[model samples]
Target: MTTTEHTPAPDAGIQTATGSHRKRLMVVLAIYATIIAAQIVGSLVTNSLALAAEAMHMAVDASGILIALIATILATRAASAKRSYGLMRAEIVAVLINCLLLFTLGGFILFEAVDRWFNPSDVAGGGVIVFAVVGLAGAATSLVILSRGAKESLNVKAAFLEVMSDGIGAAAIIVSGILNVTLGWNRGDALAAAAIGVIILPRAFLLLKQAINLIMQGVPAGIDLEEVRESIVDTEGVDEVHSLHVWGLTSGVSVMSAHIVPSAAATDAGEHPRILDELTMIMRERFGIEHCTFQFEEASHLGHEGLMHRDLAGLTSAPSVSGGQHVGHSH
Candidate 1:
């Protein structure tokens, strides 16, 4: 006999968080739009590479928030036969695209800065400073709008970080502008652009790593697989555990499934239900794993199914059964 536990998709909570925070996101997006436009014009007027790079960065920030908004809508759709997890992974996919865009934008700015270093360009320092201050004001406003939601939502947290970083980038441009105005250092503009590019690269790489890990169904960062296995084995009625697997559906949601053979005493006394309760409670209270599935099998049943000694690969233990069955992958 096989037992399975089915729960609602893990993104249910995210859907609620997104709904409440949607208005704040739209407000920030509008602020970024105005800043990007002002910076672009400032770049053209001042002939400043740093101003141009900042405009591009602000544009990227706006696009990321927009994508996140769209993803929130898609994620709310109900699950269909073709999509078991609904569109919960849409958020991850959007993040992946944003990371790639950031990489391209950062690389382009870096290349421009290098070229400008060789053939210096004249910059209007006072004009660059004016635009940088505008960018800073916008960043500060967006940060205020996103502060509340940042604690509850990953999307909001990401947008908050982007805005915060761009604010620092604006400060860098301001310093460069001041250097140009006071000391006639045309190279400072290029140096500031290069600094912004360098700052973007590490953040893009880290986000890219996280998105790819989620897509590949790798274990989430905070979970210890060995500890989970050990906890299961330590349950009172569990004789042995096998076919155990744990993975995330998205950023904050985790799911697990396992097979366990009940001890002889538990089976004889028909205490399977009690054992299930204990195991489920352990998963929920200790591991924070609310979604779980467990199959309770007898020792002879395992031998019959040719699942004698196999466990989730690399786990330290094997299933106990009376008959001699091979140890390896089960068909």
Candidate 2:
């Protein structure tokens, strides 16, 4: 019998940008699962609300990781007729879910902490110490994974952040445990749990805001509509830019549309292409925007001057005019 060896072709897309993220997410998920199991065991052994809360948070982190992994997989599919934008928005949806989970987890912790404060309970020092150490290790591992591929996708980054926060909460639990063990301060554990909630709330809020912005079709964080308009107006042949709109399809990807009036000379067919190219280049280079739609036109071609004049009267009395017919451009 002859022996044969099998070789598999590599996936270019995965190898280039997404493989590392998938690997990191899987590793982090496994680590978090272990941490959750340990926490559940430790919580029962110690009768500690802090440990239980941390365990619950770990559960949320695990779920978030799974969501991210699914989103990452879906995002790799090619755009189909039914879904023109492919699956990029899936990551945003995953991010939204993660943030909501964190927020809910934070709320639960806060409620439990308040209850514990009203009715204090003893926590086991040994169990706290062990669980805290496990948490720290998990956090450290998550940090390593996130640092390695943080730039790959926002979804992965969100999962990393959830894990990181859980790690910090674990550390706080350890500190509280040490205090309880040495000084017989039962309130410390409750306080530590509350601190965990505090840590999570801000991060959750930020993620929620970002998700909402993307869903609402709001401009990306770093981009200014006014600045974009200024850049267009500053171009050599562009007399003015108006009806400007900017929005994000997802993180780090922005789409913009605007109307521009070209100078009289730019109305010449030859000059129009040059003007369009310059504006497109400026948007790409200066603003880091790739998707753009621009309508080139003469001032007279715009909607009723009276309406535009009325709209701009308070903002600017003088309406800059230019000459050109409408020409649409997109990238």
Q: For each candidate, give its TM-score against the true structure.
A: 0.84, 0.80
What would the TM-score be for candidate 2 when compared with the true structure?
Answer: 0.80
What is candidate 2's lDDT per residue for 1-331, written digit by digit as tens?
A: 1111211123333221333478888988888888899989999999888888888888987998898788777876777999976786787888888888988999999999999999998788777888889888988888887775666556666776787788789889989988988998989889988988888899888778878988999888778877787788878877766667788776656778776767777666547777777777778778867667787655654443555533532223333354223322311
**What's model 1's lDDT at 223?**
86
Candidate 2 minimal-lDDT segment of 10 residues: 1-10
Clashing pairs in 2: 298-324
lDDT string for model 1 (199-257, tens) is 88887887788778778888776788778888888888777776778887766667788
Q: Who wins the lDDT comparison?
A: 1
Q: What value does the lDDT take at residue 125 in candidate 1?
A: 100
Model 1 local distance difference test score: 0.81
The C-alpha lDDT values of all candidates are 0.81, 0.75
Off by over 4 Å in 2: 1-20, 148-153, 304-331
